[model samples]
Every structure is written in C-alpha cells, then in structure tokens.
Target: MQTIWLTEAEWFAILRIGLGLWWLESWRHKDKKDWFAGGGIRWASGIADKHRWPFVRRGFDLVVKPRPRLMAYIVAYAELALGLGLVVGFLTPIALTASLVLSLIYLVLMIHDWAEQGQNLMMALISAVGLFGASWRSWALDDTFGLFLQ
Candidate 1:
C-alpha cells in the first residue's frame, strides 16, 4: 500500500468506479426496446430451456418465466441502478453485494459457456475486492455523507 502515484484507497476507488462503468456499459449496450418488449427474456428462455443443468432450467422457469416482463425490467434496471450507485459511491456496499450476487447467478446460468463465465467471474471478483477494501471510503458519496464509514 505504499508505492504508487495514487494512494491505496484511491486505487481501490478506481477499481470500484471502473466496475461501475463496466456495468453501465452492459446496460448501455442492451437493446432497451427489445429488452422491454420481452426479447431479452425470450432469448434467455431459449437458453434456459435447453440448458444442460437441471437446476438452471428449474430456477429460470420458476423465478423468471412466470413473470417475464417484471424480471426483464428488474434485470435491465438493476444493472443501471448498480452502475449509478457504484459510480457515485452511494450505497457502495449494497451495490457491490447485489452485483456480486447477480454475477454469480449469471455464472451459474451460463455454466459451460467460458466466455460468459470469465466476465461474470471477473465482475464477482471486483465486487469482492471493493467490498472487502471498503472502496467507498474514498472518492465516494458514502464518504462525503459519512455513510458506512468505520
């Protein structure tokens, strides 16, 4: 924690902010109209339906299929919300944890898909680093407002 132009906390903050940007990019690149119209869910449904994992199939059917529209909105907006919260250092802990969980869910659902797994694993790892390092303590709204300061 001693040999850099930026301090340790600042480095952590950069990581946190970068992850936020990644989430934002994920949200931004989506076809919002198609997603809102159920295309995204439909695509996921197709994958889930043919998934080799029984649990994934069951979980998707149980949690998402019944409420496709709601789930679609939730997934789409959740990324946007996570990005905004993390980028601004507001509710960083909650945002990191939620993003970690979301990343895990994606990893599980996309098991055997190496490309997807790599991205999800990296996202989850970054979330863990930010959470454990208390990255919000620097360059964050949480720091300014004295939230989650220890």
Candidate 2:
C-alpha cells in the first residue's frame, strides 16, 4: 500500500474548497427558475404541515406561507448568501455554522416528510459539521490574514 501525506494547510484547503463548492452547488440548484416546477410553495407547505416542532414550523410557515413568491425569493436569497459566504471564505466559521444549521433543519424536514430521504439529508448534515475545522482556514481570506476564528 502506498501512503500519501498532506500538511494541515493542504488538508484545510481541500476541505474548504470542497465544502464551499458543495454549498455553492446546492444554492445554484435551488435557484433554478423551474427548480420546483411551480410547486415550491406546496412543498414548503407540506413540510410545514408535517413538522413536529410546532413553534419553529409555525414560524417557518408564517414566513414562507403568506406569499409563495416572496417565500421563494427569501429562500433563494438566503441560500445565495450562505453559498457566497462559504465560497468567498469571508466569514468561514459563521458560514460553516449556518450551513450546518440549515442542513440540520432540512434534514428534519426531510425526515418528517420524506422518510426515505432522511438518511441522505442526515449524512449531509454530518458532513457539514465534520468539515467545520477545515472550513475555517485555507482558501479563505481569513487564512490569508488570520481573521477567521477570532
């Protein structure tokens, strides 16, 4: 068996780029015009209906419930901020944390509504947390100057 060694810097860079791109890709996919085929509202409403956390779900529904067009815009913009923040490494720790939090929320929603896909969402949430350390440095400007974890 052959062995390959990578320094902390290398490992950090790899994880940062990989996870950043993952976030960016997710945001891009969700931003597509026909992403939900005009069903985004129904889909969000359905998830709201199945939620076990009443307060949180109700809050989500209130924000995403009134007008779906507005909901879509809010969702898309939130994702865009998350994605760009991750990719740019401007606020690496905060970005990664937000990603993890959002992933966990989605995981719960998926589990409540689509049990079969719960595992996938769970895995994503786990991966997001796992990559947190790496997400702190490397490709980020924070790494370049030491502003990240402070």
Best-fitting candidate, scored by lDDT = 1
- How many clashing residue pairs are found in candidate 2? 0
Q: Rate the local accuracy (lDDT) of all candidates.
A: 0.92, 0.64
Reference-based TM-score, model 2: 0.71
Q: What does candidate 2's lDDT look like per residue over 17-85, in tens digits?
A: 566666667667663575444466677677778777887578776776777776676666666776676
Alpha-carbon runs more than 4 Å astray in model 1 = none
Cα deviation of 12 in candidate 1 (Å)? 0.7
